[model samples]
Structure formats: structure tokens, C-alpha cells
Target: MENTSCCIYTFSPYIFLNAYGGLHGGAVAAVAEMVSIACARTVVSKDKDLFLGELSMSYLFAAPRNAEVIVDASVVRSGRNVTAVTVEFRLGESGGVVYTAKATFYNMPVASL
Candidate 1:
């Protein structure tokens, strides 16, 4: 199957900020995971379900509150049972990357649901 890609614009709220007043690492990771799963689902068959296997993220810069960040996610590898995806968080349109993440998902057959 062809690779799947998606983009979204998000705002870092103060509630998701860290002690340094930047976006919390956990929040960023959550976004990466959510996007990766969405990308995986697009490449997999309708009867298959994708679950998070492994995930890793590298925070290169801080995302300040109220700043509009762009999130781009794409599938890198789509295998029979395992799929890999990458996600990037940017400052804005055509801006530098603030965070990067790589994730692997395991596909399972969906039955009775």
C-alpha cells in the first residue's frame, strides 16, 4: 500500500505547559502517538487494527503557549504485521522542526467489532 500522510495545526495551551512554561513533553508525545496511529490505519486494511508497539521522540526545541504548531505525520514502512511512522512538529508553516518522533505499530486482525 502507499504511504499515508497527514497534517494538523495545534496550539500549546498553558495547561499543557511544563515548569519552564513550554509545552509538556508528554503532551507532545501523545500527539505523535495519535497521529502515528491515524497514519497506520490508513495503510492497513479495514479488518486490521493497529496498536502501538514502540515509540520514541526527540525534543529539539520548546513550544511556547498559544503558538501555532504544525504537525506532519507520514508512514515510513508498512509491513505485513509491523508499520513504522514518523512525525514532526514545526513552529508554523514552513518553519523549523521543534520535535520529531518515530513509532512502530503492530497490526492485528479485527474480529467481531
Candidate 2:
């Protein structure tokens, strides 16, 4: 209920570091998916069934520990039966993009009886 077609969430998740002392990829993907769903819901109707059909995630740089992350998700397109959302994760301090993700959701109409 925050925005009509976009959602901006800021949080600092516990940095789960990888073996190379970088932020874990799974954590970024998980957060992106959660944000994407929220963004898609803003555009999708309540009566329709929305499902995440596709999600693409990319890691741009290594995020340091104790860094705040800003997640911005926006609905790129909303059609009669589908919606697309784009998500980006940026470091709050340096404002560098650490991860980016895109999601596609399928909106299914209610069955006619």
C-alpha cells in the first residue's frame, strides 16, 4: 500500500559473507524476489492470481559488511495478463549498485463457472 506501481524498501540485512569475503548471492536474490513480489502486487489486481514466472538476478560488485542496502523495485510494465518488475540493490554509503534483478509475474484471471 505504499506506492501505486513502485516500492522502495531500505534495510540492512546481516551480511552473509561468501568464502571470498563478499556478500552472498543467495541473500541478494532472496531479497530481490521479496521486493519484486511486493512491487508486482501494487500493479496487479486483488481479484487476479499473481505468480512469479521468471526472475533474473545479477551481481555487480562485492558489498562490504555492515553496509546498508537500499532496494528499489518498480513495475516496468503492467499488461492485461502480465506484469514486469525491476529491482536494484545499492549501497547506502557509496551508492553503488551491488545487485540487480528483474521479475516477471503472470496474472491469471479468475475461472468462470
Candidate 3:
């Protein structure tokens, strides 16, 4: 997939504080998960699918609510049954990295939902 396809989300104060004065971890995780899936989709074709077996991230810096953020993901390794992906969350203007994640996707056969 084209790198330009990566999604960019603007950080807003509402998205940061929900009846609270701090950023929500779930929001961060959600962005990471979306990037992971997007990266996996770019690698596997229609005949195949990927299951997110494991995902991990380290939030190095607090994401500011005043700047634009971009999520970029790429495949690290692809195997017969597994694919490893890496995702980076960066500031759109400064190009500073705020978070990094790694995930492994599993390709398997199971009962179709």
C-alpha cells in the first residue's frame, strides 16, 4: 500500500480529556490498533487474512493536543503463518515520534463468522 494512505488524526482537547484532565490510554491504543490493521491489510491479499495475535507499544512522550499526528505502519517480516508489523506515531509538523508499536499477525483457518 502507498505510504500516503496512512491516516492522520488531529488531536483535540475533547479527545484528550473526557470529564478528566488527562489523555486516555484507550484512545492511544485505538490509534495504534488501527495502524496495525492497516499495515496488515497492505501486506496480505484478498485470498488471505490476518489476525492480530499480539500488539505492544511504548508511549515515549505525551501527545499534544495542538498538533497533527500521523500514524505510519510497515511490515517488518512476513512468514507463512505470521507477519510482524511496526507502527510509528509522529507529529505532523515537527516529525517527532510520540509512540512506537510492534505487532504480530497470524494467518490461519478457522470457522468463518
Candidate 4:
């Protein structure tokens, strides 16, 4: 509950696009990573730094221009040295799942606080 985040993302031409005029894969991954990190940070200590260890994404459907998508990110587990998060993207109107991602981050302690 406390480790979750939800936002609406509107696809625009300003963002990268794929050959099919849908959101680019890299752009999708970037959005997923950003949201996941925010979710993970809710439980992670500020003195530590999060290094993205792994990110896995699945693009289920195409999100075209001007399409609004609901992005949801949640922390699965936040350990002392690792944090795991899951992100989902769905069409805002139809609620069809468009993308899914899972990311794992390694927590490294800062030398000075």
C-alpha cells in the first residue's frame, strides 16, 4: 500500500515512437524504470544508492499517439541489499494491459552516510 504509485501517462510525439507509431520500446523501458525506482525508494534508505541490477519488460499491446495509459508501480520486496519492483501499464479507457515490467535493484551503502 505504502509502496505503490500510480500515474497517468499520455503518449505524445515528443516522446520516442516506434515504426508502428506506438511508444518506443526504449521509452517504455525508461518509464518503467523511473516508476519502479520511485516505488523502491519508498522503502529504501536514503543513505544507500540503488543500482539497477536487472530490468525485464513485456510489451503486450501498442500505445498509439495521444493515448492515455495508467502506470502502476509497486514494490515487491525491499531487503537490506536488494529491492524488487513491478510495473504495469494499461489503457486508461479500456483498461487493457499494454506493458509489464519487473526490476531488481542492488542497494549499495554510501561511504559517507
Write down the lDDT that model 1 would get.
0.84
Runs in model 4 deviating more than 4 A are 1-14
Pick the lDDT winner: 2
lDDT per residue as tens, model 1, 1-113: 44467546466444788999888999999989988888777788988878898999999999877777888888888989998998989987559899999999998987784
Could you tell me the lDDT of residue 36 within candidate 4?
A: 85
What is candidate 3's lDDT per residue for 72-107, written digit by digit as tens?
Answer: 777787777887877887877888998888888897
Ranking by TM-score: 2, 1, 4, 3
Scored by TM-score, the top model is 2
Clashes of each: 0, 0, 0, 0
lDDT of 2 by residue, 1-113 (tens): 23244777887656588988778899888889999998888778889998899999988897877778888998888898888888988899888898999899999999989
Candidate 1, residue 102: lDDT: 94
lDDT of 4 by residue, 1-113 (tens): 34555433554444578888888899899999988887788888888999999999999988977788778888877788988898999887898999999999999999964
Which of 1 and 2 is ahead in TM-score?
2
| C-alpha positional error of residue 5 in candidate 3 after TM-score superposition, expressed in Å | 9.4
lDDT value, candidate 3, whole model: 0.71
